[model samples]
Target: TSSPTLTFNDGNTIPQLGYGVWQVEDDVAEKVVRQAFEAGFRHIDTAKIYGNEAGVGRAIASSGLSAEDIFITTKLWNADQGYESTLEAFEASMDRLGLETLDLYLIHWQQPKQEKYVDTWKALIELKKRGRVKSIGVSNFTKEGLQHIIDETGVVPAINQVELHPFFNQSELREFNASKGILTQAWSPLGQGGELLESATIAEIAAKHDATPAQVVIAWHLAIGNVVIPKSVTESRIRENFAALDVTLDATDVEAINGLDRGAEGRIGPDPAVSD
Candidate 1:
């Protein structure tokens, strides 16, 4: 079976499962991203802060897929969060990606302390209006942060990319996204390596499906309806993570995994409200 997709409020659809390039070095990002295409990933997530958009652009150029066939998403860095600066930064990112239009563009972080995200959000709206981006969203935004933009612009973000996993599910934020018609895109979907995979419960579930722990974790994310993006440079793991599309879990299994939520203690990434 192929990967499934979720619809955005804007009438665009995104592949539910995607590959991320958070820490993947630029020197090797093209190779790794090309490997993801071979592994059946159509959606790719990157950021200006990741310092790998050029490599990502290179991989896309050689993917043998048309622009419409792939979903390319990149983020706006915190340093360029003002209205005019955000527009300028968008141009730079577009130049690096070599794309006339981006599938999705996100504010990498709220950077609420800068007191500029509200203006930055306005820039994203302008980009969407001019058709530079098919969809625009935010990453690491709190419930209040998301509402602030919606209230200011009357244009809801298509998705909220956040750190979510079996451990830190961001239930409250996810619920709010659901209610507000915003998709929840998961980053660090595997809990950033073998740490969350070490859980005996996850291991047991993996055994039940005859799959790897990473696959089980990803399946759990899809089962709960979050658009998941797990980053890995290993070719085997890239292929393995995509295989979550075929894995299915039962209510009993979902309940067991949901039991792993440790609330605030399970968080593995920086708090969105405090993070850059």
Candidate 2:
């Protein structure tokens, strides 16, 4: 049951396989986070917008696992996209999570229209300097936005999390992140809208490996060097997702799955550029 980890630019490491609480209820988040821990998941991703960080904090308190043993990630919402506001939001998030230090803190979205992410990035940089957060990154940022932050702050993000799945491989964005030494992380690793779940190609490969379709997709992300976090409130599904760490996909299988890309239209989430 060994789960691989990826090292961030900050010299800290993150579990490649983790659990996320996107839409899960607060009460259910507590129990389900415990289920994920019991199932061997050492990483947990949450955000201020999730409205369940307190429940997640409870799960951590009851899990009997040391804070150092868990990799927790949370994001700063778009409304909190300025220097002081980001710091305030981070404080609020930390209070909710009940943790002294954060493993990873990210800008949930660029909000380019608001034109405040640069200030947000600087606040994160300061947080890292103060030994508050281990790593800082952005989510749903385009290449131009990423470059702007790096140029303005001269500090590259340790990771860039975006909507990724077989149906929208994000090949170019991943390549760009690689060039900049930023790890690309997959949120919604299973294609949203359930479109990729029923693919015959995926089913065939899953059958060959005697793994579930979800596990096959997760392995594909791992094999490609993308950190993946799949969310599920159901205990069985949480355990099922953790099992993806054990499955290894061959080049042939990975290439076949890569063929599922649906280009720009496949995006189930909003485009970050205009999201503001």
TM-score of 1: 0.98
**lDDT values, one for every candidate:** 0.92, 0.93
Error (Å) of candidate 1 at residue 234 is: 0.9
| Model 2 Cα lDDT, one tens digit per residue, 1-276 | 957999988788999998889998899999999999999999999999999999999999999999989999999998888999999999999999999999999999999889999999999999999999999999999999999999998999999999999988999999999999999999999975397888999999999999999999999999999999998877888888899888989999999999999989778899887888
User: What are the clash counts of all predictions, listed in order?
Assistant: 0, 0
Pairs of residues clashing in candidate 2:
none
What is the TM-score of each predicted model, taking all chains together?
0.98, 0.99
Clashing pairs in 1: none
112: Cα error in model 2, Å: 0.4
List, residue by residue over 1-276, the lDDT tens digit for candidate 1: 567989999999999999999888887999999999999999999999999999999999988899988999999998888999999999999999989999999999888788899999999999999999999999999999999999998999999999888888788889999999999998988989867889999999999999989988998999999999998889998999999888999998888998888889989878888875
Error of 1 at 136 (Å): 0.4
Model 2, global lDDT: 0.93
Candidate 2, which segments miss by more than 4 Å at Cα?
Answer: none
